[model samples]
Target: MSQLGTLEDLPIGFRQGLTATNLVPLWPNLRGALPHGIPTRRTRPLLWRYSEIRPQLMEAGRLTPIEKAERRVLVLANPGLGLENMQATPSIYIGMQLILPGETAPNHKHSPSAVRFVVEGAGGFTVVEGERCPMEPGDLILTPSGLWHEHGHTGSEPVVWMDALDLPLVFALEASYCTEGEPQNIRNEPDASQTRYRRSGLVPWSGWMRPPTNYPLVRFPWRDVKAALADLASVTPRGEAVRLAYVNPETGRECLPILGFSAVQLRPGESLALPRHSASAVMNIVDGAGVAEIDGVQLQFEQFDTIAVPTHARVRIENSSSTKPAHLFVVDDAPMQRKLGFYEILANEALPPI
Candidate 1:
């Protein structure tokens, strides 16, 4: 590569004239804008242990009530991305939200899409667009953009869930905002997950003639996912990573527009090295314990722990138990990267595309 002329190389008078005219030279910062190979990334590989977060979150619940704090959340901010920004990655925002017994997180909706993965507790539920989805541990519920959603806990214990949203991207675009409204009267009907899209290959009989909806199913039960993973693992050869993508049943695409969600299962005593992809990702441990080696850092994680991986980083995950399989809930910005036409995966071995 050739050296580019810097602003300092220009005469002081010319630099002053350009500054006065509100114009700046591009050559000096061209490489910074378009790097030689990989694009610049600020996301760092980090781990947020549930053991460490739970205490602070519980303290937050004790300190703030539902009326005072609209959504009782403790953001899992990435130090590399600046904690004040409340971002896990450039495009993804993650936080641990809590709801106590007899409390309701009022009705509201926003521009950025969000998903809630239940970490613990039961008898908690989210009503999204009139559909009431029960919150059992490990269930994944969606609160898509422009939809009305709210949370409530009917159980005795404290209910906690991981909230993942595309807030950073929407906020950066200046389109991030929410509107509070009166609580919704949930429809007297079962959610799509229970009634319409129960099976993987089958849809409602009417769906064949009716126009497909973007989100036909918003709730994914962990029981179903775990069973599916078990079935997949039965046939999956050893040394292969068993993973399944969460997609829209009708369109067979990523359920959300920006982030991609998936469930990965690592067999007992398995150490899987994932391909270095151009999308940043976060992995939430759903079951069992494991040690994740990101780039050169090793992070030991247990159930409910979350691990963040930066773009283009080598990641190797090992199941710590020799008798039980480890399950992970993964969130990635691959859909957005692919839409922007820059998603890539690099590895020495031939691996399937993400």
Candidate 2:
């Protein structure tokens, strides 16, 4: 009766929800849509320890040269996401990439925008659309989708960096494309000339090269970023934490089109509560120790640890040390979410709209 309101109305032989039933069998099928069942995320909270993987990464370097692997990366795969090549989250893909001395990764361009957060080394550079942007530890580099890019390291030591891409979002929308190209012999060896621009307070612009919607500056140097952070550190008002968003000088928005970057610092004994929103974030522990509690799980993270926070989960962060401050660099899909108008703060007071 009443259009088969419950799944029990079906035959006993077909009790499983996936099976077809006599009167549509709605109850079991509709249980996933119940108020308590919010399915915005498929990935669980994961902590990727750098210590466990660094040795393997070093081994990978000896095994495969840049010519063989093109890009030697150790992808961060979430256990909850069962796909073999699944993204860490539904909207982001993160990996630690390595480039050995005198090695160059083959040139390739893809439709999925990508960014790199340097973790170690120097004399490494990524050539994006003819401009050679040097990579240094703590520097952020943008290689927007559809740009011809390649990475090479001339330094004596190996260079490693975290590669963050909007591959999940691109492939999900069925708009993914990639093509390999010949490597460009672009180099500005020894010293990075780009750093000089910051001291002169002059913006570098090439009239011949330009891209639509991409940030004009490919590299955001750590030297300038640290200076800004230091300037704001003392003035940070009480009850407020220090956080700085990486802004595109051209548009004054997030640097990347899909991925957003922010530096968050919590003073000693500082605690900050973050409201739940419909975007996922991967936080790279920059320095110090802290605890980040998402939903109900408490994740203790130290330097170089990466923690993933899924959408629609309430989060609270605390600097566990009484004398040391905690710093984190966060990457998320907030830029894309804001663009699609799907971003919302779903605090405890209001339920997320279905």
Cα TM-score per model:
0.97, 0.83
Q: Write the per-residue lDDT of candidate 1 for residues 1-354, one digit (tens) a residue.
A: 798998889999998999999998899889889998777878889999999999999999999999999999999999999999999988889999999999999999999999999999988999999999999998999999999999998999999999999999999999999999999999999888898888999998789679989888999999999999999999998878799999999889999989999999999888888878899999999999988988778898899999999998888899988999999999999999889998998763543221
lDDT of 2 by residue, 1-354 (tens): 233256556667767544454445446556456435466467898888888878889999999877788789999988777657558888889999999889888789999999888887888888887678888888888888888899888899989899999998889889999999887766444223354235323444642245534556778877677667667777998456588888766456787778899888778877777657788999888777888887778888888788888887777788888897777888988888999888887755432211
> Against the correct fold, how does model 2 do in TM-score?
0.83
Q: Which stretches in model 2 have alpha-carbon errors above 4 Å?
A: 1-40, 185-213, 348-354
lDDT for each candidate structure? 0.92, 0.78
RMSD to true structure for each model, in Å: 2.3, 5.3
